[model samples]
Target: MKIAVVGPSRLPIAPPFGGGLEVFVHRLVSALRLRGVEVDLFAARGSIGHIQSLEFPGIDWTGFEASARDDAYPPGAMESEAAAYRRVRKLLERSDYDLVHNNSVHPAMLVMDPGKAPPMITTLHVPPQPELQQIVDTLGPSNGRFTAVSRFTADQWRIPTPVDVIHNSVDTDQWRPGPGGQGVVWFGRITREKAPHIAIDVSRRLGLPLTLIGRCVEPPYFRKEIAPRLGPDIRWLGSLPPEEIARTVGHADVALVTPEWDEPFGLVIIEALACGTPVAAFARGGVTEVLKDSPAHLAVPGDVDDLVRAARAALQQPREHARRTAVRRFDIHTMLERYLTLFEGVLTR
Candidate 1:
């Protein structure tokens, strides 16, 4: 089957660079191609380029860009995206693809003329933003099929359209544990919503050295909410490359994921698990689902004492077991097969 995968424009697809969404998009496309599916990626101008093939051998990479004017934020974000929609629509007018799998949450999906379009399926990575939701509600019912990254996100939106849940998967091979290293690790953005402060609190409670990874998109918020709390025991490593992240995680004794808000899905938890690093996270959003049957432990959200206890318990489990479970359930191959089935269903419909 021929497929067109759309990605967010705000960031590039390079690893250790974008968030879970971009990483998920890249891995999914690569996996699909390995299964002998043809794939084209629609992204920002500099995001991706022609690739010979994914590691899986048969998959090829074709890249397309959004229009020039549609590259800014806020006031023009919609217009820029609309311009991109026009580009995609024009492509659809001529191409005979089995399906167009859109990973972006933009209203552009709604803009495509369904009569001339191939069957379309979209995976909503988060609850719709206000403007984006307006677009989706207006266009989703008539033209697109919607899928949510988790049931929590789907329930939050109360979307009138048909919605399915497809949990995000990890590249377990790339994330498994290495030689056990000391210290605790925290990955993801350093925002109040993510509760980086809680990680610091856990480290202090356990008297373990802590390392913080991920970008700071909101400098002011970081300063006001996270920076003041940093001290000698805690170190900010900024963002590291994917391999570097894997290595860091692999060496760490425990991974801390404390989100103040309802996270749609905590990719870091699985990423940490892939490295054989046990996760001690707050029970929120889809985290319970991810850790449902794993060696990972969860505490009540915002309870530092509970988090500390969970962390301690996780540290006691054999690292190899956690790593093995991650490989068994969250492996890239497993994710690839699930997406293939979803695409096939869309085409057959």
Candidate 2:
């Protein structure tokens, strides 16, 4: 079946992925094409890579300049993306594809005229946004099929529609187990909300060496909260490709996840588990659910002493158990089958 997959325009679905959203889009599109589905990706520029034959990417909504680029809500960027999706209304309406999987989560995507477009399904990778929620309110709950990365996120939406909970996963083949080292590890956006500072504190308290990975999104936050804490015992490695990330994570004895806000779904948790690394995370948002059945430990949010206890406990958890948990629960094949089933159901309706 032919399909149109639209991803976030903020970042390209490429290696050294900016966030979990990019990784999800890249994996979803790649898996669909491997299954012989005709797929067209509508994503940011520099996303089209050496991937497939029937999976050529179409539109590139990159190159939009926002004067204050690093600000949380960049001024011109959002407007540019919205206008670009407005322009895409014609293309989406014209495509005779079986379905349009709207992975962008951009408000304009759902606001556009769906007059003659193929049926649409949106996977909300994040909690509800004010702009997107406003659009959903106007659309009156029947614009498209919806899914969320976690049950916590699914319950956050105030819409009158049902949102399917589809937890995210990693491709186990890409993440192999490693002989774990002595250090602690933390990976994700190095911002305050992700709270790498908390991980550093916990590591220092426990006297365990800590390694930080992933892109530095908020340099101000990094400089203020994270940089000063780095030393011989703590190291910050910038973003790496998926394979490299897997290798680095696998080598660590334990991973610390400290999120200040309610995370929609902790993709890094699964990635670490896939690499045979147990996680000690703050019991916030969807993290509790992610580790519910795994051999991981969760501490009360923001309690350094409690996190230290969690880490000590996680270190004792067998690495083999962690790997087994990933294979049994967070396998990519399971996620792909669920999405395919949802796709078929949407078509049938």
Candidate 3:
């Protein structure tokens, strides 16, 4: 099967910028090629270059920053993204792809008349905000199919499109448990919504040294809301590389994931699990789904005391059992196979 994957605009499939979506695209393309499927990746410019390409057979990486293009859309925030979709549409028009899998939320999907194009499938990683929701609703029917990373995200938007739930997977081998490192770990974007403050409170209450990893995207808010409370026990270690993250998680006695909002999916929770580290996250959104049968513990959202109790319990759980759960359920192979089934179904239709 010949497939085209459209990735996000801000980051591509290379170092320094690729986040969860980039990792997903790269892994999916590599896995598909291993099964003898031909794949073409369409990503943003500078996000991926020829040298950093994945050396998998039957896979091609094409870099184009449509979102950066002036002619792609009006000179606005999403102009380059719109331009990218226009380019993707043209590519589909002139190519023989069996399916176009769009990973980004591009407005151009609505502009393209479905009847004249090959079938397209989109995976919504994040719940759409109100405006994006309108765009998705307009393009949903024409897009042929839709998949959400989690049921919580799918329901949050109340999208009219028929949706399938496909949970994200982790590379179990790469993230497997190593010797526990130093202290407790709190890794993710340092936003109020993620509840870093809760993690801090928990760490303080337990007297366990906590390491905070992730970029502080909002400084003013962090300074006012989060920074004033930091003490010697909490070390703010910005974002680290994936291997480092795994190593730090492996070294940790427990990983704290206390989110203030209903997180669509807790990628960090699964990653921690893959490292054989038990997680104590708030029982909300997909956290419950991910930690459903694991040695991990869940607490009520925003309750620091409950979170502290859960963290203490996580520290006491058997590490071997946690590792087993991660390998059995959230392994990359399992997720890859599920996605393959979905892709094959789309191709056959």
**Which candidate's TM-score is highest?**
2
Where model 3 places Cα greater than 4 Å from the true spot, the runs are 16-18, 49-76, 159-161, 226-231, 294-296
lDDT comparing candidate 2 with the true structure: 0.82
What order do you get sorting by lDDT, best first? 2, 1, 3
Candidate 1 wrong stretches, greater than 4 Å: 50-78, 135-141, 159-162, 294-296
lDDT for each residue of candidate 1 in 209-327, tens digit (9 for 90 to 100): 89899876556667776788778888888988898999988889999999987889889988888888988999998888888874348898889999999999889878887887688
Please list the residue runs of candidate 2 whose C-alpha ends up more than 4 Å from where it truly belongs after superposition. Answer: 49-75, 294-296
**Which residue pairs in candidate 2 collide?**
none
Q: Candidate 2: worst 10 consecutive residues by lDDT?
A: 50-59
Residue-level error in angstroms, candidate 1, position 177:
1.5
For each candidate, what is the lDDT? 0.76, 0.82, 0.73
For 1-349, candidate 2 gives per-residue lDDT tens digits of 8888888777678888888898998898888889888888877766865223322232322443222122344435556666666666557887788998998766767865567888888888888889888888889755788889999988888666788888898999999998898689999887778999999889988888989998877666877888888899999989988888898899999999999999999999999999999999998989988999743398988888988999999999899999999999989999999999999898888
TM-score of each: 0.87, 0.92, 0.85
Q: By descending TM-score, how would the candidates be arranged?
A: 2, 1, 3
Q: What is the C-alpha RMSD of each candidate to the true structure, in Å?
A: 6.2, 3.5, 5.9
